[model samples]
Target: MTVLVSGGSKCGKSRYAEDIISKSGIDKKYYIATMQPFGEEAHLAIERHRKMREGKGFLTLEQYTDIEKAEISLQSAVLIECMGNLCANEMFSDSAVEDPVSKIVSGIKKLSERAGLLVIVTNEVFSDGIEYESGTMEYIKAMGEINSRISAFADVVTECVYGIPVAVKGDV
Candidate 1:
């Protein structure tokens, strides 16, 4: 089973995803962190997440790109977080992904197949209705498509608002 949890930044989607996976009764939990901590802010965010999962028995893997390349077995419950960063990382890398949406979706599909329960956390970026430069716009468009595709593939899709989860696709 795959679950897509999406919302704006700091909306509690990550915490909700943690709760869901912990309750899944899968025993083994893996937190597939995709963010590459580059500076103080990023490092702080990573620390906060680590604190959140401190007591949880999750084996954290920093698979920043090419998630399928990670050697970890996926039978355990897996949570792939913050797809927006992953998309941007792929878009800006030297081997820039021509079709980032397809690549991200493909990677998620491979992980989903092996994972007992796959939880994906992404951002709801389009609701703001703001225009941006071409590069930023391209990234946002790719994220829009990627989020849609993942939602369609997931068994459950949720949008977190003020720390509350509102189901968009399936039962919570």
Candidate 2:
């Protein structure tokens, strides 16, 4: 089964996803993290997230651009933390790859089919206020599109509010 959990920043999307994965009774769990530590704030954020996942006893695979590599490595259940970052990395890659959304969707479909259960975490960018800058607006628009595509493919879609999950597409 494919699950998609979305929420704002620090809204418990990751924790909720972890709970769902644990409750699924899947023995092998992998946390596919797409974050890259660029500076101090990024490093601290990554470390904090790492600590949270580590406390749950989840085996993590940190990848920046090649999600297919991590997808292929999973033997059982997997939780991909945040698709937005993955999409960003794919679009910003050195190689000129065409149709990044298609590529990402294909890879996600493959992972969903191969894994016993896959839970994807993404931010609901459209829920926020409109962006003032053109670049920011464009990025948000792209993220919104990606979120819609992934949510359509997901068997279960959940939205988190103040650390509580409100089921939007499937059973909670």
**How does each model score on lDDT?**
0.88, 0.81
Best lDDT goes to which candidate? 1
Q: Output candidate 1 Cα RMSD.
A: 1.0
lDDT of 1 at 127: 77
lDDT of 1 by residue, 126-152 (tens): 877889999999998999898888888
* Predicted model with the maximum TM-score: 1
Model 2 lDDT-worst window of ten? 66-75
Ten-residue region with minimum lDDT total, candidate 1: 66-75
Error of 1 at 37 (Å): 0.9
* Backbone clash count for every predicted candidate, in the order shown: 0, 0
TM per candidate comes to 0.96, 0.89
TM match of model 1 to true structure? 0.96
